[model samples]
Target: MSTALKSIRSIAPLLDRVLVQRIKAETKTAGGIFLPESAVKELNEAKVLAVGPGGFNKDGQRMEPSVKPGDKVLVPQYGGSPIKVGEEEYSLFRDHELLAKINE
Candidate 1:
């Protein structure tokens, strides 16, 4: 397996938690001009790497997660725990904290 994949799999997200990798900003504009790293905007978009088995409800029932691995999703500008493994960066957010899922 790829190092990144292996790194992500090393840690399983706890109940309702989702592992995500932020999608990078475009380095080039629509006009095709190359932009420096500083000129690029940071997007809040991310792709789900892994999801927890679901958290327990007040009645102690298991609540299934809304998202699954490989789903492109929207994340909040704040919150979520940051993690780094083998030189790669990742974030962990709760299922409710995830803003939305990207259809594309």
Candidate 2:
């Protein structure tokens, strides 16, 4: 594992929390044109780095998290607590906060 990945793995999320790193926005256009950084839009996509064991239900039953590590998830444009490990940026979000899981 890389030093950055190792550093990120050091974090163990607890209880319905998920650790994720945002997928960087594309700087180049499909037409072979390069766009300025200011013109690039931030994407809501992210990769799951780590996941909590899951939260408890109303009846005290453990509800497993919907997503697992390595899953590509779609997050909201806002929300989530930002975290930093080494030179990489990560975010912590409740399982419910995740919008959708990207199959591709």
Candidate 2: 10-residue stretch with minimal lDDT? 1-10
**Candidate 1 lDDT tens digits, 1-104:** 12445456777899999999999998999998999989987799999999999999999999999999999999999988988777788899999999999998
Please report the TM-score between candidate 2 and the true structure. Answer: 0.88
Runs in model 2 with CA error above 4 Å?
Answer: 1-6
TM of each candidate vs. truth: 0.88, 0.88
Report the lDDT tens digits of candidate 2 across residue range 51-77.
999999999998999999999999999
Cα-based lDDT at residue 70, candidate 1: 92
lDDT of 1: 0.90
lDDT against the true structure, each candidate: 0.90, 0.90
Clashes of each: 0, 0
